[model samples]
Target: MQEIFDENVFKKGIGRQINLPFLKAVSTAFKNIRVRFGRSFITIGGIFFSLTFLMSTFTNNVIAQSLLASGTDEVKFLLQPMAQEVQARQVWLISLSLLVCIIGIMNAMLTSVTERYREIGTWKCLGALDRFIVELFLLESTFQGLIGSIGGAILGFLFPLFVNIGKYGTQVIEVLPWLEILKYGAITIVIGLVLSIAGAIYPAYRATQMVPADAMRQEM
Candidate 1:
């Protein structure tokens, strides 16, 4: 049941673009908002749990650091175990972040293509060039990507501060950190834009193959 919630909520596809460029953008942005606030919290939960475990381990091994300081052989033996756990945690963090981003981009692109199939067919039948059709989708996808990426980036950066606000108090959470947001946003948008174009390829091709009469007959 818990897994089902994660699949339905934190996972993408619920909120999607409606074919209008800006509205599509807004829908994609909302999905990211859901991901950042929802999916990320779940992914980070394990990290927090592991950190707690590590803290307990450290408390139990109070003499561990002291042993290393004294160059004891036993301390040297424990180093590998500590290092391995830390490395594993780092890998999990990076992997989960990548997974979320990939999932979000793929979801947005696939949904966009699915909704615009008939529109693509119509364009193809009206003597629209293949390149034009491709470019048109690319532009719309890019626009959607830009909105989601920018909003997600901002939300991601400020999110930690927002969560920590109660603990850290208002004074410490001063800046919004725009530069970092833009950097990450640019990267995400580029990935999403590319994914959007790639996702459209098959759909666009199918649309291109439609006979004019058949395309005209497709239910709009």
Candidate 2:
């Protein structure tokens, strides 16, 4: 029993040691996000809108499927007339929105890097490595993406729910597929995370490439 207890303690110690640096980086990223709340909100807003559009499209498709499965010819007639056109357009619109959001995230991250030149230099001067800097920015963006995606998914789900409620009253809830919502919400979260990470890559790399001395010399 004593030996087992000692082994457990040793494992716990190792786990804490492994997680310490990651915790520090995450905390530092949170501090930077709080400091730049306005810019962070803008980045999140872009993600929110993009994911909202994508999820709303998915919701529409699911609703159409539900309507068809119910064997409601009238409802199907009303929906089917423009379903193909709307489906085609949804692809284009989602792509465009994602492109715009990606650009917004990239711009926001680059601006952050530019504004934090002295801070980055100071961190490097204090033994912070290039990977640490990259991790910091990535963590910050990932947090933003998580928040924005969650908000977008809720908004997207509500949009369709409200519309269907108005049309079908409480009957709408019966046909709505909860599983599909969960699936799409998960996908949206992933997309948000990927877009944020992709957007941060170039800026993080550029920030690391700058000489600490040169970065510190810049006047904001």
Among these predictions, the greatest lDDT belongs to 2
Q: Model 2: clashing residue pairs?
A: none
lDDT against the true structure, each candidate: 0.46, 0.86
Judge candidate 1 at residue 34 and give its lDDT: 55
lDDT by residue for model 2 (119-198), tens = 98988766676788889989998999989998998898899878876875665677778898899989988998999899
Shift in Å, residue 188, candidate 1: 4.2
Off by over 4 Å in 1: 1-118, 168-182, 185-189, 192-195
TM-score per prediction, in order, is 0.45, 0.88
User: Which residue pairs show backbone clashes in model 1?
Assistant: none
Q: How accurate is candidate 1 locally (lDDT)?
A: 0.46
Model 2 bad stretches (over 4 Å): 1-20
Residue-pair clashes per candidate? 0, 0
